[model samples]
Every structure is written in C-alpha cells, then in structure tokens.
Target: MAGALLGALLLLELLGGGDGKNEELRLYHHLFDNYDPERRPVKEPEDTVTVTLKVTLTNLISLNEKEETLTTSVWIGVDWQDYRLNFSKDDFGGIETLRVPSELVWLPEIVLENNIDGQFGVAYDANVLVYEGGYLSWLPPAIYRSSCAVEVTYFPFDWQNCSLVFRSQTYNAGEVEFVFGVDEEGETISNIDIDTEAYTENGEWAIDFCPGLIHHHGGSADDPGGIDVVYTLIIRRKPLFYTINIIVPCVLISGLVLLAYFLPAQAGGQKCTVSINVLLAQTVFLFLIAQKTPETSLSVPMLGRYLIFVMVVATIIVVNCVIVLNLSLRTPTTHAASPRLRHVLLELLPRLLGSRAPPEPPRAASPPRRASSVGLLLRAEELILKKPRSELVFEGQRHRHGPWTAALCQSLGAAAPEVRCCVDAVNFVAESTRDQEASGEEVSDWVRMGKALDNVCFWAALVLFGVGSSLIFLGGYFNQVPELPYPPCM
Candidate 1:
C-alpha cells in the first residue's frame, strides 16, 4: 500500500512538470492558429501602421567613386505594434516574451531603394521579438550596396554626401507611416547610430556626420505614393594615403622641372632628358587620378589640373632646350648671330638677369719676324742673277771663269719661276687662315649668348612654377568639410 501511494504521487509530479514545459509550445499554437500574417496588424483597414526605424553602422566597406557606389555593413532595427500578436502572459505560464521566425508575422518590408545591385531586401530573414502587449521588434543585418553620387571636385581632399534611401514597396504613405527611432530620453534620433564597440574604422575615409531625415513624396488623400527615410552618410577622405602616394611624389617630380632651365646650354641633351621625364611622370600621375575619379567631363580634379600645368611647363622647357642648343651650336657658316639677337641674349638680358656673357678665348701672339723658305730661295736666285757672268768668280780663285759662270746663271734663272709660284701660294694660305680665325671668334659670341639665355630662362621658369603651383593648389589647401552632413533645407 505504501509503494502504490508513493508511485501515484510521483506520477502526479511528473505530469505537472510536463504540463509546465509544454506551455511555450501551446502558446505558439494558440497565438498563430488564426493569425493572418498577410494582413496588416491594424484594427481597421484604413488605420495606418507606424514603423520606427533605426540603423546601426557596423563598418564602412568601401566607397567606389568610379562606380558611384557605397558599400556598408549595417543593422536595421524596425519596431511596430502588432495588435494581432497580443497575448496574455498569465494564461501562458508567466511567459512575457517569445522569439518567432520572421516568416510567421507581418513585416514592414522596408528596403533600400537606391541600391546599385538589383537585390532590394535585407541580407537575412531573422527572428522577431514578440512582447505580451503586441510590441514587435526585428533587427536584421544587411550589407547594403547603394548608389551614391560622387563629387570629385576636391578629390583626395574631398568630402562626399552619400545617402541610403529606404522605403516600403507594398505599402503607400497612407497605409504605412515611417518614423525615426527615439532614444531612451524619448527624443527623436536625427542621425545614424554608430556601433562604436564593434565598428571597424576605414583607412581611406572618415565619417564626418550622418543625418537621417523622413521625406514624403507624392502623397495625397487620393494617391499616396510613398515615404522614404534618407540616411545621408557624409564622409571626408583622410587624404593621408593620397598625399603620401600621389601628391607628394608628384610635387617633388614637378619641382625637378625647374632644374631643366638651370642646366648649361652645352648640356642640352641632359636638359631635354630631364624635361621629358618630368612630363612623363606627370602623365602617370594624371592617369592614376583618372582611375581614382569618375569618368566625367564636367570638371577636372585639383590635382589633375596641377599635373597638367606641370606637364605644360615641362613641354615648354623641352622646346626652350632645343632653342638653346641650336643657339649654342650656331656657326658663322650656317647661322649668323644677328646684331639684335646678340645684344638681347648676350648684353641686355644678361644685365637684367644679373649675369654676364662668357669671356672670349685669348688671341694668339704674333711670331718674331722670320724669312719663309720660299722667300730665302727666291732671294738667293735673284742675287745670283743680279751679278754679270764676266764678274762671277769664287772668293779664293782669281780666274775669269766665263763658261762655268754662264752655266751657274742658267740653272739659277731656270728655277726662279718655280720659287715665285711657291711664294704666291704661301701668301694665299696665310690670308685664308686669318679669315678662319675671325669666323671662329664670331662663333664664340653665339655660344656666350646661349649661356646667358639659359640664365634668363632659369629665373623665368622658377617664377612661373612657384606662382602656378600656388594658384592651382591653394584652393584645395583651404577646402573645409561642412559641419552638417547635408543642407538644412534637405
């Protein structure tokens, strides 16, 4: 009798515990038995369901300026009152909150309207939290790739105002109302909330501000189009990456352009080589900037403009180098230095540029008076011919050697014409040599002028580079991001 009584009490305890455990299962059946998930959880058909929305940014994936897209990781919190899901906690064994699959309930179905990809909904269909008093909250994580207009006016030093527009596809403004989520203080939140603890910072871009606003479009009593929530994510480029990789290197290379003019006129090849290299470097930088920016003809980036200026200067330097080389290599035979050009490049320009023409080579000293071989030969011939044959005699002998004297006179006279011809040839050669030396002096003047011109050009290029660089980049230096993410009227 005692064993039977103990067994009966134990069975009763087990039955009670089992019943308590099945309460959640029974609640699920009771709540969803007649629940029409298709119908809006409103009392009347005309009654509007207001959904509160809040976005928590998890990470900034990337912003593609060329593609005009913004990719981000975010969590969207949507809360609303679902009257059909209400339940009595006391009847369900003190259960207050229940988690149910999102497919079993009505959803606001807010989707990104400005999506670059064709897909519109969130990334996943998550669970919904149901409270006893008909309050439902759903937090879905999504990776949104939305369209954003990129303004590359400032470029790497630029700030952008991108937006994520969310709207309901099934419901119009009259059927569904959208409102911003409020904080614990009951104040409406105007900006996106950053998940600071979980947020990963972007290396290239920094968040300036992100403002959320509710905008209604084409909604009237007869025709209600829709309402959208615009989350404007204003971001400014960090600029450090571009400054190190693009801007600084470009500036240093552009500074090398001025060195071309400082090179001597004789080093024209070196000057041309440097100018071409600088131009090519600027072209490469321009190409890089083009790849980074959108392909638009509306405006050019500041850095690109500066690069173009540098290239133009480099081209001019190359042309000037050619001219300087031509001047240095000029000869009196081919290109004579005109009096005006000589005065400007050698005299006037040099004085104005605080320079002087190179000194001419010293003239060679005249040799001491000496008789030429031809002249000596001709003098000996004339002295022999001047004396008569009868008087011709050796100093040691006193005989009138008429026949031998006649023979010597004949030989000397015969060689006289050949000696005279040699003398005339020597005089002609001397005159030609003197003319060549004078021509060489004239050639030296042109080279000096070329050197003086190089000085003038060096200073001119320096001034132009300084002023042009300052003008082109000064605006970017002063560019400042606005405090507000978007315009106040927006």
Candidate 2:
C-alpha cells in the first residue's frame, strides 16, 4: 500500500509535469495546418516578352541582263517564347490577344553588292512583311509561353525558275531547326531516315532531296548542320504542244488550198473536184491546228492567223471557180452582150482580181427579104469594086461600116458610105467571133499555166514551211527544262 501510494504520487507529479510541458509547447508551437489555404501572395513574371532577330539571305535572287528586279515573296517561320499571362477570344473563335506592336522581328533592307559589274541598289527593296499565326491561349492545363518565326526571302523572276533562301537568328533559342525535303506524295524525306522510302499523299508531291545540293540544303538540330531542299516541278509554259506535226501539215494544206484558184472551170470534171479537195484539205489542217493549240480564249496564234488568211483566200478561189463554170456553161446567145466579161470575171478573177471591159451590144437582124437583098447587093458591089469598073462595088465595101462611119468617110467614094456600113457591121461581128475563139484558147492556156504555178508555189511553201516549223519544234525539243533556283534552305 505504501509503494502504491508512492507510485500514485509519482504518477501525479509526472502528469503535472506533462501538463506543464504541454502548456509551454502550446504557447510557442502550433499544430500541422493547410498553410496554402492561408493564401500566400505571389508575383507573376512581367507580361512583356522581348524578341530580337536578324535575317540574311544567300543567293535568293537572279536578274536578267539589264538587272531588272524580279518579284518574289518569302515565308519565315519563328518559334520562340512569349511571356503572356492571359488572352481572350472573339465570337469567331479567333484568338483575341494583345500584340507587342513592334517591328522587333523584321526584315532588314538587303543591298546586293555586285562587284563584278559594280552594280548597286539592285537588291531587296522595302517590301511589307505579311504576318501570320501569332496569338496566345489561356485554356490549356498550364500557362506556357509561345513563340514563332517566319521565312523572309524573295524569289526573283517567275517562281518557275526561282529559289528563296532565308536565314533567321533567334536570340532566345540556342539552335532550333526543321527539315524540309521534297514532300513526295506527302512523304517526308529526312537526312537521317533517308533510307526509308515513302509515297506521297497525292502523286503530285514527289518531294525528294536534290542530289547535288543536298549537302548544304537540309536542316539539322545541331548548330552547324545545313539543309537544302530542291523542289523540281514540271510546269508548261503554254498548255499545248509546239509541234511540227501540227503546224507544218496545216500550213501545207493551206498552201494547197491556194491551188484551187489556178484550176479552170472549163476543165469540167477535174477543176471543181480539185478545188473541193483542196478545201477539204484545208479543213483538215484547221482541225489539226486547233487540236495542236491550247484550248483557251486567249488571242489566236500567229500561225492560226496565217491559216485563216489562206482559208479566206481559198473561199474566194472557190467562188471565182463557180463563176468560171457559169461562164463556161453559158451559150453564145446568152453571153452575146458580154462574153469577155464572163470569161474574165469568172475565170481570171479566180487566179487574180483582173478587170474586164464591157462587151458590145448584139446586132439586130434585118427582115429576111431585106437581108437577102443586102447580101446580093454586097456580093455584087464587092465584085464590081475589085474591077473598079463599077463605082457601086467600091461603095459597097466602104459602106460596110455604120452610117456614122460611112458619113465620116463620105468623101472616099460614091456608094462607098452605104457599102462600107454593111461591110463594117459584118466585119465587126466576124472580128468579135474570132476574138472570142482566141480568148478561149488563151484562157485555157493561162488556166493550165496557173495550175502549174500554183503547184510549184504550194510545194515550195510546204517544203520551206515544213522545214521552218520542224526546226522550231526541234529546237524546243532539244531545249533543256529550265533549272529551278534552289537556295541553301529551300
């Protein structure tokens, strides 16, 4: 019982000491708490993000002999850090963010120094830089900074044979790079994984690393790596074949069509037939020419213009040929007024537009009894005039002319004026008939000669024109596909 009491007393004292220790700890120490719930104050980094960049181009432009400027646009891509806390959006969902509003990242004026020719001020001019894709978003899980870069280069003349080189220095990033190879069929070719051959999304993008310039054409993650990507594209100057097969044959047929004018209508079966054949040939050529040329509403080709000229000329030939045939089919009675006009306008105009004189009016026949009496008088007067024994005979030949003609020669003989009028009328008709006969033969000869001449001209034109057209086509064929200007970067 005594030991128990001592233990109780000790325990009470120990409890009292523990109580005192608890009171002391409570005065100076505290229990574990959610200190974060106490709302500790913090400061965010400045919203202003600074960026500085310099770009240099190497061999990005080419000039003609005159050094005239070629226009081109370059694309620059930059990836950097932007210190922004928050951003807004518009109803259209466009990122509504504040822009720093500075030309910190810009293209500097580049001056091309051509030492060989000592030409200056012939380089990149002051051109506006079009910006794209520089916005901020705050909806992500974490607040991350964003950055971007652009490709700033120029392609000199037509982009078909131009290359653009762009170099950008990002002060914030140590060395950031990307690879651009021929995106063949959308299959990317990389320097490291070049062995892996891939296809394209479509057949068009057969992107491949240019064989010769590859060493300095591709990009690398390391600082000293180089990249060059050459995109060889096949674009036609005009969407049609400059072919002799088209132009030569067409020109030749056109030349042949010109031959139609030389064929005479009097040739019966052959003349019209030949002209029709030539017309058909020309039609074939026109069809062929249309096929050979591009199907565009653009201006007609020089050759087409010439062919049209030929066709028009040929149509005239055909029309003249028809006229000639009409003249040939005409009877002497129907053509009595103007036989010469018929042959000339109808026949000769087919060869060339030659003028003809108007024909004489037809003679009116006297009554049968009057005609017999005049014939008897004419024969008697002619016999007597030759004898010089009868004055009436001399007068008869003299009166063969018209009354007007006889009156003019009235002093020559007694019955001369009347006799001369009769003889003159008869002689006029006879001479006209003789002239018609001679004209017919001459026209025939002329027609044949013209056909021959036309044949010669057509053949000559064919050979010469064919040779010229062939040379043009051959030159185009041998001509090299223009080399694309591929800079070191792209």
State every prediction's TM-score relative to the real structure: 0.80, 0.30
Candidate 1: stretches off by over 4 Å: 1-20, 88-91, 358-437, 485-490
The deviation in Å at residue 217 for candidate 2 is: 12
Evaluate residue 157 in candidate 2 and report its C-alpha lDDT on the 0 to 100 scale: 8
- Residue-wise lDDT of candidate 2 within 192-235, one digit each (tens)? 12112231122111222222222243334653443333222221
**Candidate 1 vs. true structure, TM-score:** 0.80
lDDT of 1 by residue, 153-202 (tens): 77777888899999999999888999998899998876888867889999
RMSD of each: 9.0, 21.5
Number of clashes recorded per candidate? 0, 45
Residue 412 of model 2 has an lDDT of 55
Worst 10 residues of 1 by lDDT: 390-399
- C-alpha lDDT of all candidate models, in order: 0.82, 0.38
| Poorly placed runs, candidate 2 (over 4 Å) | 1-209, 212-385, 388-428, 443-449, 480-490
